[model samples]
Target chain A: LAKTTQPISMDSYEGQEVNITCSHNNIATNDYITWYQQFPSQGPRFIIQGYKTKVTNEVASLFIPADRKSSTLSLPRVSLSDTAVYYCLLNAGNNRKLIWGLGTSLAVNP
Target chain B: EAGVAQSPRYKIIEKRQSVAFWCNPISGHATLYWYQQILGQGPKLLIQFQNNGVVDDSQLPKDRFSAERLKGVDSTLKIQPAKLEDSAVYLCASSPGTSGSPDTQYFGPGTRLTVL
Candidate 1:
């Protein structure tokens, strides 16, 4: 199983860009990094996913280094609605199970 | 297309009592999953089902937890004699393809179980 480590929490102000990084030193070659955001009393919602390099979507951008040992989720011009817990997950093509660690709780203040 | 649907948004029961949760996956989804999310912790996969067959239940406590997906559509997870440690949010998710495929999973609102 691949394990991920990220910050316990983060604080940001509205209109600022927030970046959360996760480290997975033992990640497999076929594993893909995925991010999810969860608000209070709700299930997690998928944000962005990437295999290598960078992948951008309307919601967020995912940047992966060449070693694939670490990945960063960047939220541009974040607002108070972006306040939530963000999770980093490794999805393996061969395995169906997903191992989730304690996510980084982001607080976007006005 | 509707996302995954779980009934009884909240449930409260005493220790040693029985409880059951129902889940209806999205139309045409072939893979279904059940997860347990404890307070201040991430979601933990409890079981996974491929169509109507059980694919994985390794993390599920078989002595007290049992889940079934009948006719490849709806699923039911039952716990006989619940424990205090079982108090958590039960989440249901579904995907269009199997685990080998790179498909995003759709999640439901989840059922919050409170075991007293």
Candidate 2:
């Protein structure tokens, strides 16, 4: 399993775009980068996932560099309801497990 | 399109007691997983099951915690002689079984257990 590091918290005003980056220096070649959003007292929901390059969905976008060592989750035109904890997951291999980290807490204020 | 379902949204119990949480995965999902989320921390995978067979349980405290998916659909996680550290949210998730498959896991509203 690859360990991931992200910010403890981030504050953004409403209507502003927020970008939360996760660093996984030890990410393996077979690993895929997945991002999930979690609100208080709720389960984590999938936001976006990408192996490389940029992948955009209706909810968010993921940017992965060529080295695959880091990835950034971009939320465009966020609202107050978008405030939540964001997690970056890395699945190393078949036998490897999903290791969770203290994710980035995004607080969108009006 | 029903999502995963977990029972007894909240539970409060004293130390040395026992508590059980139930979960029903999405229809046709062949893989199920159970996770424990402590306050201010991300979820930790306690166990994973492929159908009715156990796939991984490296993090499960087998001495005090036990889980079973008897029919390969609904699951029950039991904690006997609970301790203060057992206070956490138990989450159940399910996904299609296969490597390299584009199966995303669907999670249920977890069971919040408070042990005093």
Candidate 3:
């Protein structure tokens, strides 16, 4: 099983870029770093995933260092609607446990 | 394409009672997952299914919780003798089951279970 650690909360204003970092000191070799976003009363939605280096999507970007011990999710020009809890996940190989720690609760203000 | 679907949207039951949640994954998807999300916490993977077979259920509380996916299209998660701590949002997710790598999991709206 792999574990992730993130900040409890973050605050950002609209139109600003936000970066949420997660630490996984014991991450495995075949693990992939993934990020999810969740609003109140709804399920999480996948934001970005990357094995190493950087992976960018329409909504967000995932940056993983070569050591694979940590990853960062960046949201460019965030808006009030981006207010949600952000999760960092370590997908550790097959038949492995998926760990979803208490993620960073991001509050995007107007 | 439609995403994962779960029902009923909300459920309320007293402790010691039993309640069940149903989920329908996206059409043609071969992987389904069930997760439990308590308020103010991230979603925990309760079970994972590949087609009609279970890939993992290590985190599920087997003493009171049970889940099954027959025919591989839909799944049901039942909690017999529910407890107050069982109150949370039950989420269902699905993936394309791409070989060599598991694709992204698309989540549903989730079913909120409130045990009083």
Best by DockQ: 1
How accurate locally is residue B35 in candidate 1, as Cα lDDT from 0 to 100? 96
Sort by DockQ, best first: what order? Answer: 1, 3, 2
Error of 1 at B43 (Å): 0.5
Interface RMSD for each predicted structure: 2.1, 2.5, 2.1
Q: lDDT score, residue A8, model 2?
A: 96
Q: What would the per-residue lDDT of candidate 3 be over residues B34-101, giving only the tens digit for each residue?
A: 99999877788899999999999989999999999999999999999999999999999988877677
Comparing candidate 1 with candidate 2, which one achieves the higher lDDT?
1
Candidate 1 deviant stretches above 4 angstroms: B98-100
lDDT for predicted candidate 3 compared with the true structure: 0.90
lDDT of 2 by residue, A2-110 (tens): 8899999999999999999999999987888888899999999888888899999998899999999999999999999999999998864332388889899999999
**Per-prediction DockQ scores?**
0.63, 0.56, 0.60
DockQ pick, better of 1 and 3: 1
Residue-wise C-alpha lDDT for candidate 2, range B4-109, written one tens digit per residue: 9999999999999999999999999889999999999999999999899999999999999999999898999999989999999999999877677445677899
Worst 10 residues of 2 chain B by lDDT: B96-105
